[model samples]
Target: MAEDDRSFVDHYAVLGLPSSEEGTKISLEEIKKAYRNQSRIRHPDKRPNDPNATADFQFLTTSFEVLSNETTRSCFDAKLRTRRERVLRDSFQNAKRRKMATDLEQRERSVAVDPSQEVRRKEKMKADELKREIAEFKARRMKKAFEPLNRKDNVEGEKKDSSLDKGRMLKAIWETSAGDYSAAKLRGIFETFGIVEDVVIRTNSLKKKSSAIIVMASKGATVRAIQSMSGDTTNPLLVLPLESIAPSFSSTSSTNQNESMGPEFNNVVGAGFQNYEAFVMKKLQEAYEKNKCM
Candidate 1:
């Protein structure tokens, strides 16, 4: 291996096979199985444009090639064994030094000192306690001064945070015929607008279809997402604010949410959603009238 690649290229570790310590005896079948599993996880297409992904995938392939064939396998196994032995030897030496250093420190601390030294140590300890008390006093005063400001900000922050609470959450519905509304896909679509806190996919057994509820970080995020994702009828996907959906579907609880979300969740941005829609519609109408005059 080259100097640059040496740090990262561990063939056995990458292949998820037994190390030299485990008496490396991986079968050809095991190697092939491990490669397929790891390749799926590290494939370039799955992680597009990743700077290190291509190199890592190539390294994985190289490891498989070297370890599978008899001639290369012998050479590689010999090098791996030597590397493991060197690592184990270094570890043992490090542990021994650490134990010796700890023993010395304990011995020095346990030994009695002269009277003058003891007096100086007691005085230093007293001084440190006084300094610590003074620091604590100052901290308390600063905290008291900032209390009102923090409380006020927290009230506003809490209102928004509670909406995205695990239980009784506020979310938007995405009704799509795409048949592949994965959480990752939805996150990718909406993340550019704002933070997506969670995505919930529920099967509608009656309709034999699937829809998703997206929980955004804030009302502004929800508005931005709706504007971008559901701006026109020409778009196949129908993005509606949770407040607009029928209560049965929109206000339904997630099976995963066991924790109690307080009554404050009722205040989540329903009115804001309506206002956002009105604003978008007004803009569209204005554009339409202007084009008619033209």
Candidate 2:
């Protein structure tokens, strides 16, 4: 049979099969199975302009020529058997060949390690470590990004995070270094945003300072800010994108809100954003066009 006409072919050398391995004694059924798999992988049509692939395809063609014929298979089997049976008894030749291959591999690995690669890897590691130390920045950005994700418009309408039967809300507490200015400065910070309904920062019994259970005007907005910061603690400077503060929800029917007006109730709190007047108008326009409100 011509090389191209064969369904598949794999030289034992190409497939990493030991030199001793031969197709003569193996069942024809096994060869066909292997051929189907290797043919699809090494087919020239499958690999575009790959020199190794072209060579491999050629070798496979030669392999098929030998394996598919009973007479040719007999010859290959005899040669392979002879080589393996002698390799164990003739240790000197076998050891020398193995040593040469091992030395070549070691030299290749040495060349693979360019000094530039080590420099880049260390630089990346340092940047990541710096970010992890500045945990406060990551938290703030995470809070901002996540706050706006809340589905303010529950399917029924005007649903808040605590209200939804399913869905979660962002709950990130502000972080400040331990100092006289920390608690006061943190309070002033939250006060400036006019978003925090309640914030309690204190030195714990362990003498460690922490902020707990802070409420936000828009939990969704806070979360949006934070997620935008980044999950990779590599760069402290890459704050979350400010534009992510806007909630992504389109509209919701107030009727869908929990009738009980529980934690899910939309509290008419002031957002206190600097561009409040402009922002409110934009939201009003969006709500009007959607025809969500009566």
Candidate 3:
């Protein structure tokens, strides 16, 4: 056998005894017993026809000689332990070298770059950023362009809020020179312009005239009612704001005064009209002319 193979040969395995990579665990007596059994089986004189019997017997005798002595056996066991540890250490070092080489190769491949692809990637990023900026600019421009329209819509919304039930309460007077007007009839007539919250009819028996205090839901409704109803001479309605009436004819006092002094209430209302008569007549005349043209 080769010298390297001879150096790796286990003496306990040669004697047919149980052994491990670390070392054997046999006493001198146990070694002698194992040696005697192996010598009987591997002896040249006992195996006359076997061609390799002499070499096998020599190997067995060498194993027996080494294991039978304490000092030699200790040296052999130490050499076996050192050889096992060396093999393990070499295997670990080889594996670590292979991993480092693989990592270096991967890093080199990762560092290798395509210049055109890099430029394209940067250009794509810039384009995306520019698109985002343009979108933001367009949004700002659109908002600025529509600002006037938005303000107009807000003004219309404010007008609607004031004209509905939420804002100021306005009052108008409805006086008829000839016909008697019921509260329900007046409410029905005035509701065409807007909401009529209330209608209070007052009759003057001596003058044969009827008038009503119309409580409108809002200023817009009151204005619209006055514009539409003021200039009809046959069924005249002196639609005026309650604030335009005399100081004595307040909202609270008007009802009481109308009930107690029926004809005198009309007189007081006429007296209050002196201040606003021209303006009211102009608007009434314009409205009448417009209606007549229609």
Candidate 4:
């Protein structure tokens, strides 16, 4: 089958990203990485002894081979319109086939078919097909995009928590998305944060905070990374400061700041690495000034 003729991944869909609104150009490494993802899923060895699986494998392999080349992905995008369209085309076709089979069963049963119903059914079926295709296209793109996290346990099981290895101590936290780590991007995410010494996520879990820790690579870099990702979903910054973590999570609001400002909870009043370090520092300095004056 032709790659575009119901037999290839849409290039945009494969990348797990939307086509660039700003005319962003595709890069070689991005294409290569996407192909690598398709390879893992569509490789024949991973498939069972099913004819459909084999076809899927071949199709996926072809997609990778073709799209990985700079020229091919550009051509494919024009043909597919949006990445979603390419992803959904095959799935839509498959659903059409199933509906045809069911229609055959209905005919055999001599089900009463109103002419208007048939017309409406035709229109509705078309609309539903489009929706299904779009949804599946999204799913396919996300699947490929996050293929890293959703792989077999061998990959995820490698989540490193405590590495006495190489004298690298760790206090890292593995922070997957809300559900299972359905993608293998955790290690990179942590490294992006501060290069904790180690990182790990459970094989069949989706709890954020995987408990990977690495020492910060550079104070400047780590700080910048943290500042940039304040509202990050995987690692939400403190809505309240770290110094406020104890009180923020513990109490609703600090109505009596004077009464609660005790030395024992100095740690609790410190800003976390995630939010407002400057403000925390300023507050500490202000308190020192007041104490000196007294």
Candidate 5:
């Protein structure tokens, strides 16, 4: 047979002894007989005219020498086993990678088929996010509205028990639309008012809109803060005044006040409002005057 026609080279196959899995248990006598039979046909002297006769004869001789030695045959078997294992491992790995690639391509094709569904999903997500933010904003507003009533109760409780009055610690409540202000920023802002005892920020989260309560060192300092901070300036402010937190304070028309005040202050109450301190101070003055008239 032509060299190109041969599938694979094996010592047993060269000798014409079976190389298949079931024929691996051939006897030494069988191997010698097969080798002798192959050699005679492939001998160069017997086929001197053939161009590949020498090469064929040499291959037959090598097969006999390797198979006849027990050590060489054992080593060749080990090498063959290792090559088979390596081929199987490579095939498994290639198959696994091909399967993964196929799955990814299928997913891409699915997405390409219905891109509109993806867009709709993203839009719904955005809408839900907006609704959540709006709900949080409304909750904060409600808390702000009821702050005065809560403070009123605390003041009344303090009044009923004289011993509880440890020289009325003056405190002021402040709200800011910009939630980026840290405790240090709050302290810096209100430190000008008086010796600050403690600063407490209340909010659902640090990143959300928040309120701060600045406890001043003395009532005199608190009084000074009410007078100085409550005023109109080039820049408007967003803050709650001392009168709003007082026990006697009450809105003349709660519903009307909320409807009117919420809208009226909208333009000036956001993070963009400039001169925030002054604007809030002016609003507090208006609220104080309105309550006094009522």
Candidate 6:
């Protein structure tokens, strides 16, 4: 037979022996026993009426010849192993292709059933991504804004005084549409009224507005800034003292002038100031007068 024809045949199967153990473990005696039994059963003389009996008997003889020799048996076993590996590889590839086709078909069916669901799912994914990006952007911006303060504290080798009174703080609100203002710009603008210790800018993205927490060196500077900036048509900022927002000092009824004024506010509100309330009223009057002149 041709080499191709020989490769296609399972030699041990023809003699009715287990093909798995045939070449590796089957003894020569065992192969001979199987061959004798098969030869007797398939001999052409025994099946004279069967025309294909001759061909079958010839193939049986060839199988016995191949398996009986050690060299031929080893070669046949190698061919069988190669064919089995090729078959397994092809089966795996076909299965993979079938699973991919099935998945694609299911997706198409689902989209056809409810196309709006796909649209909604994609839109939700985009919205979630946008929210995450915005959150990260805001976090980066906050870290950048405070980096200078952090570095300054490190260089000075001192912790900032957290117990400092909030009474020296002023809130300045401005429209975002006006322009972008940095801490340095804000400090320059407010330093004309008093010594600005710190300027912290905050923004409301939704409202399109910005505000600054301006900490002055003393309560006197805080009151001076509030008096000068309030209701000033020239200045865009709307300034309010922290005392007005949330009063820090105790109120007292005083008949004598200058009796209730603290040492910090003595220079800002000179003589005739009866109390803290009177000093605030006087400053407001002065601001009104200044604006009326302007």
Arrange candidates, best TM-score first.
Answer: 6, 5, 3, 1, 2, 4
lDDT per residue as tens, model 1, 273-293: 344445555666677689989
After TM-score superposition, the amount by which residue 242's alpha carbon in candidate 6 deviates from its true location, in angstroms, is 32
TM-score of 3: 0.35
- What is candidate 6's lDDT per residue for 1-294, written digit by digit as tens? 357656687888898988754456888899999999998999999999999999999999999999898899889888888777877898999999999999999999998999899789999999999999999999999998877666676756544455668888988777899888889998998798789889998987898778889999987788787666653556667676554411223332342222333444333331222233555666766776899899
Q: What is the alpha-carbon lDDT for the whole of candidate 2?
A: 0.51
Measured with C-alpha atoms, the lDDT of residue 169 in candidate 2 is 25
| lDDT, model 4 | 0.52
Cα deviation at 106, candidate 1, in Å, is 2.1
Candidate 3 vs candidate 4, TM-score winner = 3
User: In terms of lDDT, which candidate is strongest?
Assistant: 6
Per-residue lDDT tens digits of candidate 4, residues 198-263?
344334255334443334444444344434444454453232211232223234334434235344
Task: List TM-score per model, in order.
Answer: 0.34, 0.26, 0.35, 0.23, 0.41, 0.42
Q: Lowest summed lDDT over 10 consecutive residues: which window, candidate 6?
A: 267-276
Error of 6 at 218 (Å): 43
What are the lDDT scores of the predictions, listed in order? 0.66, 0.51, 0.68, 0.52, 0.63, 0.75
What total of clashing residue pairs does each candidate reach? 0, 28, 0, 26, 8, 0
Ranking by lDDT: 6, 3, 1, 5, 4, 2
5 against 6, candidate with superior lDDT: 6
Error of 5 at 237 (Å): 46
Alpha carbon lDDT at 13, candidate 5: 76
lDDT, candidate 1, at 139: 100
Candidate 3: give its CA RMSD in angstroms: 17.7
Q: lDDT tens digits, residues 1-294, model 3? A: 257656687888888887665246667888898888888888999999999999989999998899888899889888777777877898999999999999999877765754466678899999999999999999999999877767788999989966655222334443345455677877898899888887776666675445567777776776666545554433355555454332231233445534443342343344333335545445656776899899
The CA-based lDDT of model 6 is what?
Answer: 0.75
Q: Report the CA-based lDDT of candidate 5 relative to the real structure.
A: 0.63
